[model samples]
Target: MDTVAANGTGGDVTAKIAGVQALLRGLTILDVLADSPDGLASLADIAARTGLSPSTAHRLLSTLVERGYAGREPGSKGYVIGHRVVHFSTSVRRRTSDLRRLVRSHLEAITAETGETSNLVVLDGKNVVYIDQVEGTHALRMVPGIGSIFPAYTSASAKAILAYQVDDAQLDAVFTAEPRIKLAAHTLADRRDFVAALTAVVKHGYAVEESELAEGVSCIAAPIRGRNGVALGAISVPGPTQRVLEPAPERLGVLLKKHALHVSQALGFRQLSCAAG
Candidate 1:
């Protein structure tokens, strides 16, 4: 009886090892499919690239398709990256909960230091979402509140993050949609002006909006970046227009930039400022 039990345990161990090896092989095939031009690859191509037998490759691809991490083209019988894979590739939704906790202290500190409303905002599609906010002491303070989303083109926080992004085509598509014109008080007169503003923001390490998104509100923001220089989010201080820039927004801009740098460094951005690049 003890010998039979020992044999069972060994069989379980062997099965686990085989399962892990199979998973690795499956991922290798998926990687080949993902890297293919047009993002689709024939079974023969995947089998050749992964050095797996044709039947083995087919089995693995079929399993991946069943799991929604891969798909097969009906006409061509080629494997492509599945919707589930693509969906997760671009979203950090699962990480946001943990990230928010890590960033909240920085937000509170920024508000305390500036004596004004501070926000932590991230780019979501063509808009920016305010994930968190710290209200100012003043009765007339400008507050967008948490979970509010605003146009990426007109928001200082959004612009600060967008200025570091390297996708011109996506940016252009968002700007050209709808009536194109945003707020009536927006200072950017045309697409050309908007492009120039982003360029300046990249050069200056911060962005500012003055009576643009709203009637009397203004804000200054700086980008928080990842180790790869991708803008993760932005930190901004908002207040009444005159006070935001009365002495010029430069002072607050500088402070925001410093805090942004600190938070970004904490997130593993060891390189020089994204503005420098």
Candidate 2:
């Protein structure tokens, strides 16, 4: 009986070891693809980056491609990052209960102070997902329902968070992978213009979007940082474009920044300062 029990334990340990090995191999494939310039890496490139033999790399790549965690570039016969990564990231963001709870009061206060709708959004891969919201006192107010997802480039909240959190290389990869699609006349269409806007946001401590998300709607947003001084999400106050454009964008920007800082402090973030120009 003791011998049978020992055999069972050994079998369990062997299974666990195999699972960890597979996970490590999968992560190696992703790291190799992520470092590639055009998001494509040849089998040789992947093998070199992962320090695995050609046959081993091929086997892992084939498994990743089959499971949708990697993809093969058409006509190039190279490997690249895949949509499954984004899907998995989104699922993780959606499951963050602490972030939603932490920013709830900030959203409410912004709505109370500005008489405008407020939203809290978190980065989900290259996009932003609204997780919480507070409606304004006014009967007619801009509304972005909770759970709505928007492009990180076009939304003020998204840009505010992205500008602070993502490195230039990651930002470049984002734009290259999913080019901005204009939702309104004021939306940025060119890559250089978009980069310029992000630079401006970094300098100003907050970002303002004038009818970039929807016609007749605008938003002022500031980033919420975590204890590690990394941006975790954003807080935004949104209203009609006419009201936001009324020669007082700076005032709105200031209010948003203050509220965002309050939330960031509550979340234990210490590096609260305007980005240098």
Q: Candidate 1: where is the Cα deviation over 4 Å?
A: 1-95, 187-189, 273-277
In candidate 2, what are the lDDT values of residues 1-277, reduced to their tens digit? Answer: 6875667987787888999997897786785575443458899978877778999899989999998989998888898877787586557556877877877877777777778888888765555667778988887787756655566666787678767753665466456643345768787656677777877787888888887767888888888877666677888877887776567788778888888878778888776353332
Residue 3 deviation, candidate 2, in Å?
A: 43
Please identify model 2 stretches exceeding 4 Å from their true place.
Answer: 1-94, 272-277
What would the per-residue lDDT of candidate 1 be over residues 215-256, giving only the tens digit for each residue?
677889999888778788888887888878879878888888
Q: Tell me the deviation in Å of residue 190 in model 2.
A: 1.9
Predict model 2's lDDT versus the native.
Answer: 0.74
Best by lDDT: 1
TM per candidate:
0.62, 0.62
227: Cα error in model 2, Å: 2.9
**What C-alpha lDDT do the candidate models reach, one value each?**
0.75, 0.74
